[model samples]
Target: MKKTNILKNGALGALVLSVTFGCASTQQEEPAAAPAAKKDTACQAELAAAEAARKKAASVGGEWRDTGKILKSAKKALAAGDVAECIKLANKARRQGEMGYAQALEQRDNDVNSYTVERGDNLWNISGKDSIYGDPYQWPLIYKANRSQIKDADLIYPGQDLSIDRAVTSAAVNAAVQHAKTRGAWALGVVEESDKAYLAR
Candidate 1:
C-alpha cells in the first residue's frame, strides 16, 4: 500500500506541473485586418466636368453663330437684287434681331402710289413727283391699275383725265398745303396715301 500511494502522488504532481508550464509558455496572435476598398473618386470628378463643358459649348454654337450666318447671307442677297431670296434669309435671322426682322419683312412689299395718269402725263412726270416710285420701271404697277382706260400699259397720253382718285384724298389735299408750310411732305401716313376711306367709315 505505501508503495502504490507514493506512485499515485508522483503521477498527480507531474500532471499539475505540465498543465501550469503549458499555460505560462503559450503566446497570443493578433487578428488579421480587412484590406481597404479601392475607389475611382478622381475619375468620377473628371467625368462631371467634361459633361458640363460639352453642354455649354453646344448652347453657344447653336444660338449665336448659326443665327449670325443666316443674317449675313440675307444682307448679301439684298445687295445682289435678289429681293425674294433676301427675304428668306431675313426670316432665318429672326432669332438674332432685337427689334424684329419680321416687321421689316412685312413692310417691304407695301408700295404706295400718290398720283394717277392725266392728259399728256408720262412716267417721267409721275415718278418725278412721287417719292415712293423712285424710278420709271415701277410705273408698271400704275399702268396696270389704269390699263382699261390707258388702252396700253406703256402708251399713256396727257389730258387722259385718268383716275387720280386712287392717290388723291382729303388727307393728300391736307398734306400738300401742310407740307408747303413745313418745308417737307412729312407727317403723312402711307395708309392715307392708299386711302381706304370707304372701308374706314
Candidate 2:
C-alpha cells in the first residue's frame, strides 16, 4: 500500500510540474516576443538599400515579379514595429533586387537575348515567355529585330535563330507594344505592311 501511494504521488507531482513549466515557458516567450518585435535602427536603412537596388533593376528592365510586393510588405512590418519580420523580408527583397540587376547585366553583356525557334513557336507566344519579354504585345520587337532571319512577322520556322533586343529603351518597348496591339490582320508567309512600317521606324 505504501509503495502504491508513493508511486501515485510521484506521478501526480510529475504532471503538476509539467503543467507549471509549460505555463512558465509560455510566459517567458510572450515577454520575449514583445522585445523581439521592437524596431531596430538599421532596419530602415536596409529597406532603403533594398528599394534602391530594386529601382536599379527596373532601370535595366530586369525587375522580377513580386519583388515590389515583398518590399511593400516589409514596409508594413516596419510600420507595425515588427523589426525581425521587416529585416527578414527586407533581406529577401534585397537579394531579389540584386539578382535581378545581375540578370539584366549578364543578359546585356553576354549575347543571351537570342531564342531558338521551336516547331510550333510563333513570335507572339515566344515574346510572351518569361525569359523573353513576358508580353505578347511585344512580339513586333522580336519580328523587327530578327528581320534578317525572319522574312515575315507571322511566319517562323523551327531551328531559326531569332535575335532579341534586350537593350531597348522604354520608348521602344512602348512603341512595340502599341504597334502589336494596333496591327492589322496578317496574311501568312508574307510580311505585313504594318510590320514593314514598324521595322522602318
Candidate 3:
C-alpha cells in the first residue's frame, strides 16, 4: 500500500509540475496590422454630386425626407477621413434625390385626370411631360387607357382626349416600367410586337 501511494503521489506531482511550467512560459507577440490606405480627396466629387442632386430634387418640391440628412452625414464622414462611408452615403442620397424628383413630376397635377392632345403631342411626348407620367416609356399606360378610340398606337389626332391611369398598384407600375426598358424595337406607323406583348400582359 505504501508503494502504491508513493507511485500515485509521484505521478500527480509530475502532472502539476508540467502544468505549472507550461503556463509559466512566455508567449510570442502577435504580428502588428498594416496601416490603412490614405484617401484624402477620393470622395470630393461624390460629395458635390450628392449636394447637387439634393438641391435639384428640392427645386422641384420633391426632396425626400431623409436625403438631406444623409447628405449631411456624408459630409461629416468625409471630414472624418472615412472615404468609403462618405461615398456610400453620398450615393444613397443622390439616388433618393433622383427618385424624389420623379415622384414630384408624376404627382404634378393629380387633380386633372385627362389630357386634350395638342397639335405636336404624341403618346410618347405627352407621357414624358412632368405634368403627366414623367417617363416616355410609360406611354403604354395611356395607350391602354384610350384603346377604344386609338387604332394605331403610333397615330394620334390633335383633338383626341386621352386618359391617364394613376390608380395602379406598385407591382403593375414596376411591370410597365420594366416592359418599356426591355422592349426590343419600334416603328413609326405600325404597332410594335413588343407593344403587343406588353398590352397582352
Candidate 4:
C-alpha cells in the first residue's frame, strides 16, 4: 500500500509540472506575439502616412527624388524589423513633402500677372513696353515666364497667354542695376544713376 501511494504522488507531481510549464510557455508566446503585432501595425501606419505625404507633394510639382529615397529607406527599415528607424525616416519624408507643397503654393501665389501675346510681339518688345518692365534686356524674364508656351525665346504666337511674375522681373532689374553701377555705367553715360532715368523711352 505504501509503494502505491509513493507512485501516485510521483505521477501527480509530474503532471502538475507539465501543466505549469505549458501555461508558462503560452504566456511567453502571447507577449511576444503582441509586440510583433504592435510593431507591424505601427510600421503600416508610418508607411501609409509617408505615401500620403508623397502624393500631396507630387500634386504640387514638388521634387520627389529625395522624398522618394527617404520613403524607400523607411520601407527597407520596416522590412529589416527596425520599427523605430522606419518611423523616423517616414516622418522626415512627410516633412519634406509638406515643405515642397508649401513652396509650390508660395510660387503660385507670387505669380500675380497674366497677359496675352499680340501680333508682332516678340519677347524683347513685350518686356520693354511701358506697361511691362520697360527694359528690353529683360526679355529673358518673359521667356522664362512663358516657358511652357514659348519653347524658344525668339518664338511666341499671337493670342498665347503668358505668366508675368513681377517678383522675378523686379529681382532681375535690381540685379542689373547693381551690375551697371558696379561697372561704372552711370559715369560712362551708359546708364543713369537712378533706375527711373534708365526707363525705356
Candidate 5:
C-alpha cells in the first residue's frame, strides 16, 4: 500500500514539472517573435523614407551617386538583420540627397557670364571687343542696357561697371542703328538730307 502511494505522488510531480516547462518555452518564443516583428517594421519605415528623399533629389538634377552607394549599404545592412546600422545609413543617404538637390539649384541659377570694366572701355569699344559683341555698331544695345548708369549715349568713362545683354537679335540691332542715325541727323539740323549723306559720316 505504501509503495502504491509513493508511485502516485512521483507521477503527479512529473506531470506538474512538464506543464511548467512547456509554459515557459511558449512565453520565451512569444517575446522573441514580438521583438523581431517590431524590428522589421522599423527597418521598413527607414527604407521608405530614404527612397523618397533620393527620388526628390534626382528630380532636381542632383548628384545621386554617393547617395545611391549609401542606400545600397543600408539595404545590405537591413538584409543582414542589422536594423540599427541600416537605419543610420539610410538617414545619412537621405541627408546627402537633400544637399545634392540644393547644390543643383544653386548651380542652375549661377549659369551666367560676367566681365569687369577696364581702362579705355567705352560703350563702342566694349561692344566691339571680341569678348563682347564683336561689333562696334552694337554700342546702342550696351547703352540701352546701362541706361541708369549712362545718361548720355555719346559718352562712357573708363573703369565703369557695365552689364552686357547678349540677347540682341539682328532685327533689334538694325532698329537701334536706324534710331541712332535719325537722332544724329535731327541733332545736326539735317533732317531734310538724304539718308545716305547723313549716314556716310
Candidate 6:
C-alpha cells in the first residue's frame, strides 16, 4: 500500500511539471510570433513598393523595336537616293510604331516656317527648332530644294522668301499650323498637291 502511494505521488508530480514546462514554452514562443508578424508586414510593404515602381515605369512611352528598324530602313532609303520613297517609308514607320511618334510628327508639321534670315542666320539656330531633322546637316536638303530663289545657299539675305514644304495636303497643313500655334511658333504655309503640280497658298 505504501509503495503504491509513493508511485502515484511521483506520477502526479511528473504530470504537473510537464504542464508547467508546456506553459513556459508557449509564453516564450509568443514573443517570437511578434517578430515574425513584423517581418511579414515589412515584406508586404516591399512588395507593394515594387508594384508601384513597376506601374510608374510603365507610364513612360518608350521606343519600340519596330520603330528602330523602320527608321533605319527609311534612312537607308534616303541614303540610296530615294527621298520620296524614304519620306513615305519614314511616315509608314512612324505610323506602325506606337511609341509617341504621332505627337512628334504633329510637332514637325506645325513648326514649319517660311523663315527669312535676320541679321544673324546660322544653321545651328535654324536646326535647333527643327528637332525631326536633328542636326544642321539636314540644312542642305532645305537649301537644295529652294536653290532657285536663293542666290547663295550659304549667304541667304534678309528678305529672301524661303518656301518650306511642311507637308503635302491642306488638311495636313492646317493640322500642322494648329499644332505650331499651340506651341507659340508662327505657322508658315504648307505645300499642297494641285491638279497639275504642288502649290502653297
lDDT of each: 0.44, 0.86, 0.78, 0.70, 0.70, 0.49
Write the residue-wise lDDT of candidate 1 on 4-92 in tens digits: 99999999999999988777665222122111111123223333343333333333222234555665566676567555666666654
The TM-score that candidate 4 achieves is: 0.58
lDDT of 6 by residue, 1-201 (tens): 999999999999999999999999999989987865674454444334433333232232223436556556656765675555556656555444433444444655666656666667743355445542444434433444465765334456666666555442424433333433342221223221220131122
Candidate 4 lDDT by residue in tens digits, 116-190: 889988866876775565566666566555656665455678999888755543345555445334433323222
Give the TM-score of each candidate.
Answer: 0.26, 0.54, 0.46, 0.58, 0.51, 0.33
Off by over 4 Å in 3: 1-111
TM-score, candidate number 2: 0.54
Top model by TM-score, which number?
Answer: 4
Q: What are the runs in model 4 whose C-alpha is more than 4 Å off?
A: 115-154, 157-161, 164-201
RMSD of each: 26.0, 13.0, 11.6, 12.3, 15.6, 18.5
Which 10-residue window of candidate 6 scores lowest in summed lDDT? 191-200
Angstrom error of the Cα, residue 175, model 2: value is 5.4
Which pairs, if any, clash in model 3?
none
Ranking by TM-score: 4, 2, 5, 3, 6, 1
Better of 4 and 5 by TM-score: 4
What C-alpha lDDT, on a 0 to 100 scale, does residue 190 get in candidate 3?
81
What lDDT, from 0 to 1, does candidate 3 have?
Answer: 0.78
Clashes of 6: 0
- Candidates 1 and 5 compared: the better one by lDDT is 5
**lDDT: which candidate is best?**
2
Judge candidate 3 at residue 141 and give its lDDT. Answer: 79
